[model samples]
Target: MARYRFRFVACDEGFLRTFAGSAWRGAFGGALKRVVCAMRLRPCEGCPLAGTCIYPHLFEGRQGADPVRLKSLDRIAVPYVFELDDVVPRSFGAGSEVTVTLTLIGDANRRLARSYP
Candidate 1:
């Protein structure tokens, strides 16, 4: 497993609810797809690139093209998680900083490292 920390300084005043995990996850997923989807395929069900695409691997937990194998598994847990501090204030003023920690398990870190670097 590997961990990474990202810091963001608010440019303007904003309010984030306490326990913003869902909000963060939604934003991250959308942004990731936008940045990585090359074929512009909606749903990604039959896209030829799904097996090797980072978007599906990270967001949808899809591994490969084996239909039977994919159907046999009930659920494939996402390979990454978010670690947020409970004590951080939810509301932000201009210049307020927020730190988000992400942990990637197993081959996830290695896969992403190749994509990014």
Candidate 2:
């Protein structure tokens, strides 16, 4: 059996009240709520599809508003990628240097990370 997972990430606790409710405003309703839609993805376990779905987050940035559009969602300032690189393998220093990436998931939750290798 394959294992995929969905995580509940909290960026703004106060705006959550708007996300859980079922309401429609118009012209693509409440902006904050739509921008935070979540999902689970299958991690590649040596699958050929990995190129399109793993490693450096084979899904990161692209237009999610073609098949579906979210109004002003791009304006949402949410950190998407959080990376910690250890120069000394965590044996010394304070902690691994963290690289926080701000990204957008394309339609179908797909897009290769812009960093080449």
Which candidate tops lDDT?
1
lDDT of 2 by residue, 36-112 (tens): 32222333344444333323232233223232444544323222432222221223223323222223343223332
Stretches of candidate 2 exceeding 4 Å from the true structure: 1-69, 85-109, 113-117
| lDDT by residue (tens digit), candidate 1, 1-117 | 999888888899987776676777788889888877888747778788887777777778876445344577633778899877545446788998877788888767767876777
lDDT of 1 at 7: 84
Error of 2 at 49 (Å): 26
Q: TM-score per candidate, in order?
A: 0.82, 0.20
Clashing pairs in 1: none
TM-score of 1: 0.82
The reply for model 1, stretches above 4 Å from the true place, is 65-75, 86-89
RMSD (Cα, Å) of model 1: 2.9
lDDT of 1 at 32: 81
